[model samples]
Target: MKCFVAVLIIVTLATDAVSEASVRTCEPIKVAMCKNIGYNQTGMPNLARHTLQADADVTLQTFSPLVQYGCSSQLDLFLCTVYVPMCTDKVALPIGPCRGLCESVYERCYPVLSEFGFQWPAELDCSLFPAENNHEHMCMEGPGERTAPVGTVTLDSVNAGGRSACRRLIKPNSWVWVRGSSRCAQFCEAEVLWESGERRAAEVWLATWAALSFACTLAAVGAQLACGDRGSAGERALVLVALCRCAAAAGWGVRAAAGRTAAGCAKDSTTPTRMLLAHDGLANPNCAVVFLLLYYFGLAASVWWVVVAGAWRASVLRPSVTTSGTGTRNDRHSSLLQLAAWGVPAALAAAVLVTRDVDADELTGTCFVGNQSSKSLLALVIVPEAICLLLGTVFLATGLRAILRRPVPVPAPTALLTSPPQQITDQTLLRLGAFAALYAVPSTCILATWVYEYAWREDWLAAPVPTEIPSTQPRPAFWVFLFRIFASQILGVMVAVWIATPRLKALWRKIAGPRKPPLTKCPAGPPPTPLTLHCYATHSHSLSRSQMHKYATYRPPQQHSYRKPRHYHYSAGETIL
Candidate 1:
């Protein structure tokens, strides 16, 4: 019995010693403002998350202006407890403010940060601290924390997190910090980070518009098909362009329709609390599918746009062997056009896949390359997009110049006009202009929006950190996202408009209106046997003697009757299916 008690006593003493010695670097609070508040000893890596005492003092010093402004009476204790957490023999883990205390201070002080174009610092995330002082999760629940009078700070209608913070604040099912980023930024998997209906509405809008775009592209392709080979070289190339648009719109439509599911979102390799898309191409199966459709097909559509413009320029500059289709040059360019439209995007997509540039865009909930990475955005999107526009623009401008320079053929004044049919009406010119604008305008706008996003990406990745000057917090514009969704799909609808011309309508009617009954050849047969009739002289009652004798064997004078010829037809041996 005595031995058993002695061993038990020794074990208890050992546990107490370990607990007491847990804080090795306990020392006096070096921060000036924090010294006057209750607790004296502090541990390293203060709650402001400064590692060194000197650094902690400096960061806390920056907040002196707000402390002086008196947002909260408890602000001093709150700041010190976090920046210089309580360290003592009584407690092993440093004692930081309770979640309630942290939230209270946050509510008061975030407004001040807002004024200076800042967000609530991630270091002081209230959720990171303990809920209450307890054995397992100990924290400093300040005396009468609930009973303490609240501060005079105004909590405005604006969320204290500000737009950038609010935009990024996702309630993720699972998350990891975006790889290579220092801030607590997460790549969410499975949902969009929307705080209000406005954001949700954007997603719905994209899906609906994309569906419309798909329908429009189908209409354009349908019209082209119905017109058969009658459309010009430019219009023919437009058929291919419309087909590409159909594919891209379908991809985007898939993304919008999926709506906050695993298919559209991706994982960030780095923060647990936050989820952002990491650059891992084809890592998610749905992401891979979307990438091919939007990137490969979208790029293909742009290349085809270049082909459309180039065909127009060729018609004006090279004229044609005949106006029926185009010059021989067009036939020669067909192989090159196919290579450009398909092969180039395929190569680019292969590169993006190997490099894993695919990322899920937050605003649209669509997996695409360059949504979260600036490098990917610049290389994969901005550069290629700009180059496509540049080429198309050059072709369009050259073609316009050619058309304008063509000589006008004034009718001769004698004007009996040895007339041949012509179709150079003002309406035709207007349709051409509208077609060119529709093609170029949406493309240019999309590129411009991409440039803005590329510029805004770095700031977006590192939120709550004020990189910009205090005067402006240039948050990534919500309109940029909305515009991107609209412009990306509007090209397809515009193509439909271009195809809705009177010319195509007439051609459609001619091809699909009514097939005429085909003419057939007359049958080859022996000539009609001569109709043999021996004419006997009419009874000579009224005839003279000589006339009666001469006419005796002469046929009843050949009597002719006028009537339409009987037509005969022979089948060509074609079997209708």
Candidate 2:
């Protein structure tokens, strides 16, 4: 009976050895286990391991079957995924020196899958080599029944191996058979291998956005340098330049987006399995960076143009009070003309900027309004913007305050009175009045927006975006509108127009017109001929009658005189006689 038991033990060990030998040619997946796989299997075997890849495309994979076992904690959950290409795949590739096929293609994992009654025999297929072998050679095998108990499996670690050999082997009809026990393994491995070309495409997209961004920066800076001043014609030219730049930038953006989408479609067309996971990390960065920067710069420029308009208005209204003939204050009308020209463009630019964000959906790229990192960032942009617009309005108001108060010039009664005052020119008054009236509307609107945003409530920024958009706090509505406005340079053209208008020239012409002669009575005929008169008093001295007569007739006046009234001589130094 003892011999029978020993024989049964030997036979069991021999069967186990043969089973191990069956899978010797196929290398085990090398995975670092968190929990021992054989601790508590319900008569099932644990086959957790790691696989390594050779190409630059495939990354890493892990597998953990513990999820099915109701293991809740990280320790209880084993992480397992697939590694592409077997050990045989590496040996077939062009390997580097120092590191052979295995080392070059993949990393070796330790603590082999020996816990589940598995033995990695040092010498595998020893009998397969038939050098000097007999027909029946003696051999021994281990027990078929394993004594090791199954335990809960846990995921311990994951390491990135360079790439997958399977990726290099992937072709038209290549099929990867996944072991069903590990769920995440197949998908993870497949993505890593298939994403190489897609990643390169994404890099190209990013490069294009960056190029467009830099180009736009140059164009903007150039435009500012070229037409920095106000006036309708100059502003118009500048606006046209700005519009060109914006259109170019927008064009680049559109192309980039199309390229990205096309690349995704192409990938999908070729690889039916890659349809759901089309969007990758590579394409996102370029799209976001280029689009946002362009949008912000463009918006900033727009806001600047509006401010410029306000500035122009303020400037026009500055010389409102001038010295009238009577030392009184007088208004200039040219200010109003200047204001109207500048303010209209500014207001229109603002309106455009405020409304542009509504069309942002078609342009997947992040623009000024849609791409705030946090609520605080959005607030930071909006509050300052609202304040700027507010300040501009204030400037306009202060400038225009005296416009309505200008006194009607009192017309004089005489010909001189009827003529316009020489002191205060009609051109000057017209400019002042024009500036005050025209700027009043837009500047007031700016002030209103500012009040609504920064003052009406704490939620001043709420006007820009809809209430339904999720937010931790209110965001100013100006941002969304400003983006589209900024993107277009119509304001710049308007500025040019303001600087070079027919009215502006006309005002100057009216100012430079010939001056009318000052009021004066015609010079009464030429002054009286130079005549000498003498008045002689018939006094006591016995002077020549001729002298007395000379005194009475034509007196030559003495240069010096004293009021010695007792005796008076009108002309001669000698008294009466």
Best by lDDT: 1
lDDT score, candidate 2: 0.34
lDDT by residue (1-577, candidate 2, tens digit) is 9999999999998787566444434334333342243221111122222212221112211123212211122211212111221223212211111112112112221111132233423222122222321333211121121111222111111112101211222220121211121111112123322245544544464445445544554554444445443332223323433443454355445535555443222122212333211222123444334344344444344344344445444434553443342122112433453454345444543443443221111122222332211222234344544554565556556655655565666765674863565444445435433533443344344334434433422232122333776755443453432333232323333333433353445555556896678998767787645443444344555656775565446555666854222343354333322
**Where's the lowest-lDDT run of ten residues in candidate 2?**
153-162
Please give, for residues 156-255, the per-residue lDDT of candidate 1 as tens digits: 1122222222234333222222213322233453333334465578878888889999998887777667656545667777778789899999898767
Residue 543, candidate 1: Cα error in Å is 45
lDDT, each prediction: 0.67, 0.34
Whole-structure CA lDDT of model 1? 0.67
Off by over 4 Å in 1: 1-175, 178-185, 189-196, 267-278, 412-421, 424-430, 464-472, 501-504, 507-577
TM-score of each: 0.55, 0.32
* Candidate 2 wrong stretches, greater than 4 Å: 1-46, 49-59, 62-77, 81-294, 306-310, 313-317, 320-360, 363-377, 405-577
Q: TM-score for model 1?
A: 0.55
